[model samples]
Target: MLPPIYTWLKASNAVKAIIGNTPRAYRPGDAPQDVTQPYVTWALVAGVPDNQLSSTPPSDRYTVQVDCWHTTDKGVEDLAKAVRNAIEPNAHLTAIPVNNRDPETKLYRIALQFDVLQTR
Candidate 1:
């Protein structure tokens, strides 16, 4: 069975820090109920090839993806930044909106791709 959503979020220390210790609110409002609350339906981390590292063919870059519901567009930008910081602190991360349903469900799903050079 899939792990509980809260467990998944808490599994990462970086994620925990980004979202403080507090139960998130589920209601549609101006402010998020708590720091830990995610309007997110799903989130994950992945790795990609590092083509720039010609000397190191084994090197790979890290990436993160987040699917969430947003009440406003303003929060979408910040949410992406928060996600990047949570997953890739050292690497430069960029978020792109793969699917956006702003007025309908207010859901703003984004896929953030970045490069985290692997080291031995």
Candidate 2:
């Protein structure tokens, strides 16, 4: 099943303003190398099916890591805020956001973890 994160971000005008409309968000390794700055990438880091007494689980919970990247620190911070504003209404923030600059690429990145529950 597709995660709702992509759908939410793509639908948000704030996020589209920074990342563009065509490619709003990408899977961990799916973004093209030549992708422009102020882009977003996400991955499902973990999942757990709900347990029940007698029937199959009717829902699942997922932990996803979403990362915003840009050449400028302020740009990445703005992108990350947009992403959070889009997803935070439905998903719960699971970890404190972490940011760092890649020494080799000099790209600034901010990573956020969220927990999303989806019905099966």
Q: Which pairs clash in model 2? A: none
Model 1 is weakest, by summed lDDT over 10 consecutive residues, at 22-31
Q: Point out where model 1 deviates above 4 Å.
A: 1-37, 40-59, 86-88, 94-99, 102-105
* Candidate 2 residue-wise lDDT, 59-113, digit = tens: 9989999998888989998998999999999899888567999898899999999
Which is the leading candidate under TM-score?
A: 2
* lDDT tens per residue, model 1, 43-80: 33665555564565455655544454445554555555
lDDT value, residue 47 of candidate 2: 92
C-alpha RMSD values across all candidates: 8.6, 1.2
Candidate 2 residue-wise lDDT at 114: 94
Candidate 1 local Cα displacement, residue 36, angstroms: 9.3
Clashing pairs in 1: none
Q: Total clashing residue pairs per candidate?
A: 0, 0
- What TM-score does candidate 1 get on C-alpha atoms? 0.43
Q: Please report the candidate that would top lDDT against the real structure.
A: 2
